[model samples]
Target: MRNNWLIAACCIALPMATGAIAAYVTIQNVQFWYPVLRKPIFTPPNAVFAPVWTILYVLMGISLYLVLREPPSPKRRLALVLFGIQLFFNFWWSILFFRFHSIGIALLDIILLWLFIILMIRQFYRLSNKAANLQWPYLAWVSFASVLNFSIWYLN
Candidate 1:
């Protein structure tokens, strides 16, 4: 149905829109704020971040959409709330790392973010396996990002 398609589109748009807003915030500080940092040895090239985040954001949107398509229940509602909380952490990491230029705080924030992602994934699994599966890439990325954040904080 057209309505179903529209709902799906909107669900997908939510995370993508959040990512876009986060990216906008990050870019504002990256050039002047980021360049001076003492990056870790394994830090990926600057160009790698945008494409990787774009794909991850799309996947995140798809995962949320899958969860939203299911019938509403208390468990489902709780899962949605968890998803939103993790997203807040996700969005703020950029602000902590880039805008405020606080690497140590960013590292701590990202560890919390990684834990939230795991909780979100488990919650998603209870509602929809596909949704939970879709979040694995995000979990993996955030896990990696957590280590990177720690390394940056430690090295710098």
Candidate 2:
């Protein structure tokens, strides 16, 4: 039981930590570079991003924890692998868009990220439906983000 709790803690911490690192990379660019870009009119206020991302990260952590708690199986392994892959793309999207200012490339990365999220959710469903359902908001947000990303690239 203690081991399960510890694993849960680690699961939550890992994604939150990843978000923190990505946020660090994003802050300066968001302040200095992002303001100057020609964004789509639908863009949310800058103030909205942090809180939204924080919540999403927490949800993602919980989703991961639920999946990780499932019995060991090839399906579980695949789900875990998909989660890690999507997280990698999620982290790097900040660097690609904000730090490097490669908006087009960032759009590509985000599309891939979105696909991986779908794959992850599908696999998670096999193990835990709640875990899979938790990812829907994340997917919805990323779907919006993908449009936002493409718009940013197009307009700018």
Residue-level lDDT tens digits of model 1 in 82-133: 9998989998999899988888888888888898899999999999999999
lDDT on C-alpha atoms for all candidate structures = 0.86, 0.94
Q: Write one digit per residue (lDDT tens) for candidate 2, span 96-133.
A: 99999999999999999999999999999999999999
What lDDT score goes with residue 134 in model 1?
85
lDDT of 1 at 83: 90
TM-score of each: 0.95, 0.97
Query: On a 0 to 100 scale, what is the lDDT of residue 4 in model 2?
Result: 84
